[model samples]
Target chain A: MLNYLWGAMIFIGILVAAFTGNMAEVTNGAVNSAKEAVTVCITMLGVMSMWTGIMKIGEEAGIIRSMSKGLRPLLKWLFPSVPEDHRAMDHIATNVIANFLGLGWAATPAGLMAMEELQSLNKHKERASNAMCMFMIFNMSSLQLVSINIIAYRTQYGSANPSEIIGPGIITTLVSTAAAIAFAKAAEAAS
Target chain B: MRAISVLSDLILPLVIVYILSCGYSKKINVYEVFIEGAKEGFKIVMDILPTLIGLMMAVGILRSGGTLELISRAVSPIVRRIGFPPEAVPISLMRLVSSSASTGILLDIFKNYGPDSFIGRFVSVMMSCTETVFYTMSVYFMSVKVTKTRYTLAGALAANVAGIAASLTLCQYLWG
Candidate 1:
C-alpha cells in the first residue's frame, strides 16, 4: 500500500514540478526534507529513549502487569469465546496494556501472539471470527492513554504548552474507543 | 481550556514520579533498568530513521512541486463547508496510509502554521485518536491468512470516522 503511495508521491511531485518549471525548488525540497528527517529523529531520540526508559521502569516494577490485570474484565467482555485460562487472553491483555502505555514495540509481538492463539481457536481457517474482529477493532480504534510522540513534536516545534493537548487527546481517544466497542458489538450482534 | 491545560500539565510529571516510586518500591536497579530500556528506545528511533527519511522526501517533493497546494485548493471549499480546516485534509488522508508519512504532513503543518494554531491542535488530537486502519487490518488479517475479514474493516473505519468527528468537535469547543 505504502509503496505505490510513495512512488506516486515522488513521481507526481517531479512531474508536476517539471510542468510548473519548479524542478529546482523540488530538488532542494527533497534534499532539505531528508536532512530534516535526521534532525527530527535526533529530537525524537531523546524523548523516545526517556519515555521508554520510564515505561521500562514501570514494566519491571510490575506496574504494567497490574494495569493489564485491570484490563482483564474488559478483555473478557471483548473476547467472550476465548477461555479465561487461554494463552491468547494473556497475550491480548499484554498487548492492550502495552498499547495503552505507548510501548508499541511491546504491543506488536503480543498482538501477533494473540492473533495466532486466536487462530488456533478458529473453526474456519478462511474467515475471521467474531472475536478476531472485536480484537482488531479495539486495536485499530486507538486505545492509547497519551500522545507521547505528538507531544514531543509539539515540544520540538516550540509549543508554549506542549502537553496541553494531552487532556483533549485522552478524551478524544476514549470517545473513539467507546464508539469502536459499540460498533464492534453491533456488528457482532447483527451477524 | 485553562483547567484542562493545568490538568494536562500534571500528567507527565505525575507519571514519571509514579514509575520511579514503583521501581523503588520493588527494589529494582532503576538506573540500570532505565538505561537498558533507553537503549531499546534508541534502537527504535534507529529503525524509524530510514522510513522517516523516505516519507519526508516524498511529502516534501509533493509539497515543493505545488501539487499539494493544487489538491488542497481543490478540497478547501468542500472542507470549509464541512467546518474542517483545509490544511487538515491532507493530514487525515495521509494518516490512513502511513504513520511516518502522516508525521511528515503534520510537521509540515506545524511549520506552515505555528504548532499553537487551531489546525495544528486539531490534527494533533485527531491523530491521537486514529490509527493506520488499512495497514493494521491488512497485516493482522493476513497473519491468519483470512481473505474474508467481514466486519473488521467497517468497524475500524467507523471508529476512525467517529474519532475524526469527535476530535473536530472537541477542538472547536475547546480551542477554536
Candidate 2:
C-alpha cells in the first residue's frame, strides 16, 4: 500500500509537472522538502527530549504507572493483544492524555515510544502486529479534546467567535473515533 | 471558548509541577533520570528520519505539481452533491498528507470567505476533527520498521470518511 502510494505520488507528480511546465519547481520542491524534513527532525528532537524527560519523572514517581493502571480496562479493551502490565501501556496512556489536551509535542514522542514497545512484542518483526495497527489507527482517529490550532487560526482570521467550532469539532471527532474502533475491531476479527 | 482555553493552559503547568515534585519527593535522581530518558530522543529521531524525508519530498512534489488543485477541481463538484461545501475539498484532501499544506488552503478560505461564514465554519470543524492519516502512519510505522501495515490505512480511511460525514452533519444541524 505504501509502496503504491509513494510511487503514484512521485510518478504522477513528475508527469503532471511536465504537463504543467513546472518541472523546475517540482525539482526544487523535492529538494527543499528534504531539507525541511531535517528541520522538522531538529524540532522533533527538542520537543521529544523535554517531553520524554518529564514523562520519565512521571514514570519513576509512579504517577504514570497509576494513571495507566487507572486506564487499564479501557486500554485492555482497545488493545486486547497487549499484556496488562506492558510498558507500551504507559506510553500509550501518556500519548492519549497529551493528545486529549492538545499537547501534540508531548504526544509524538510517547506515541513513537509506544510503537517501539509494541514492536518488541511483534511476532513477525517485519510485519505490524494487530496491536500496532490498532494503536496507530486510534492515533490516526486522533481523539483530541481541543482543537487549539484551529481556534488560534480562527482568531487570527478575525472570526467573531473563534472557538465556536470546538463543540462541533469534539462531536465529529468522537464519531470518527467510534468508526475507527469499529473498523479496527472488525479487521482484527476478520484476520 | 474562554473556558476551554483557560482549562487547557492550566493543565500543562499543573502536570509538569506535579510530576517534578512527585519525582523529587520519591527520592529519584530527577535530573539524571531526565537526562537518561532524554537520550532516547536522538535514537527515535534517527530511526524515523529517512521515512520523514521521503514522505515530505513526495508531498512537496505532489503539491508543487498542482495535483491537489487538479484533484480538488475534480472532487469539488462531486462533494458539493453531498451538500458538503466545494470550497473545503482542498483542505480536506491535503489534510490527509501534509498538514501545513492544508493550513495554507484553510487560510485562503478564511481570507476569501471570512471565517464566520457557513463554509468557513464547516471547514474549520472538519479540519479540527481530521488527522494527516498518511503522515501519522508513515512516521509511526517507520520507527518500528513495520513494512506490512495490513488494515491500519484502511481503518484510518474509514475514520476519515466518518469524520467528514460527521462534520457535515454537525455543521448543518448547528449552523446550516
Best by TM-score: 1
DockQ of prediction 2: 0.44
- Model 2: residues with Cα > 4 Å off, grouped in runs: A1-67, B1-73
What DockQ results do all the predictions give, each relative to the true complex?
0.81, 0.44
lDDT of 2 at A165: 81
TM-score of chain B of each: 0.94, 0.61
At residue A67, give the lDDT of candidate 1. 80
How do the residues B1-176 of candidate 1 rate in per-residue lDDT, one tens digit apiece? 77767778888999999999999999999999999999999999999999989998998998889888878888988988889887788889888878889999898777778789998899889999999998888888888798889999889888988999999998999987
What tens digits encode model 1's per-residue C-alpha lDDT throughout A54-101?
Answer: 999999999867888888888889899999889999999998888888
Task: Name the 10 consecutive residues with the lowest summed lDDT in model 1 chain B.
Answer: B1-10
What are the per-model numbers of colliding residue pairs?
Answer: 0, 0
